[model samples]
Target: MSVSTETRIKWTSADLELLPENGNNYEIIDGELYMTRAPHWKHQTSIARITNALVSWSNQSKLGQTIINPGIIFSDDNNVIPDLIWISNKKLESCVDEAGHFTSAPELVVEILSQKPNDIKRDKETKLKLYSNRGVREYWIVDWQLKQVEIYRRYEGKLTLMITLLDDDSITSELLPNFSCQIRDFFL
Candidate 1:
């Protein structure tokens, strides 16, 4: 099977406008449209575990709302579909667009790295940089296979890898007060 090269895909705001109302999982980065199929069972399991934990915490407290696999527009023409996003209600209300574009950056974003070589590299390096440069306060890179999570926080005008948690270590977010999850539980 041949994947479409970036040059072959022409991206525009109008193109994004034509996406189905039901919504499809896609992202446009630098005008290169990337279509993602449903993740594998292992990936979905990990995501469910992590998302459930965040949802529980967010629900009880007013920390933020955890949205899973939502369409997020990063720029006028750059759209990104993050695995998860935590946006304060204030941010969510203010960033609204009828056309599905988010006018503001998310406070926290999570990207679960897939086993595919191309995806792994892009999630770790490229998307990591893009989210940070766009002023996302905290970014979490979840490595399901390794059972590890890398936490990155913006600091001094750059995104720095603050720590990597493994096994039973609890992953806490500086962006969301009192938000946490045990790394081991993320795999369950």
Candidate 2:
């Protein structure tokens, strides 16, 4: 009888740079690597709708910037490209590095759920815990198929589910003052 020992490879930000410039999306979470193919048309449309709303609000408020598919590098071992991110000008100045990658958590991170089971898990469970632990003030999980948005706000030092806005309801964030959008807008 023989005993075998196996060591898992821990991925880092540097490893991501070496990948081919294909359309695939790759992320390193807790030193593990995860990949996803290009998003569907519906996903892209939802992102566009959400981005437009956030951009319009931010422009008037002059509070921060709404970025689409920004690379948020929380650590060498935890680099993720969220669907969208909203970072205040104050926090943005400190978190963004010379390379234009966020070195810390943004004020709000938005992720659109895919139909794939693994992708859904990565967004809901893996990324939820990651964002909560890393001090993301707010997180939104947008489900296109279900046409709902799950909002998580930081409470008691952890991201807690505050609400789920249905198509009939409007989505609002405490992090974004005076910002509200009809949930139906996301699908349309």
Candidate No. with top TM-score: 2
Model 1 clash pairs? none
Off by over 4 Å in 2: none
* Clash list (residue pairs), candidate 2: none
- Tens-place lDDT per residue, model 2, 1-188, is 99999999999988998999888999999999999998889999999999999999999999999999999888899999999999999998888789899899989999999989999999999999999999999999999999999999999999999999999998888889999999999996
lDDT of 1 by residue, 61-101 (tens): 87678888777777755788888888998788888689655
Query: Over all chains combined, what TM-score does candidate 2 have?
Result: 0.97
lDDT agreement of model 1 with the native: 0.81
For model 2, how many clashes? 0
TM-score of each: 0.87, 0.97
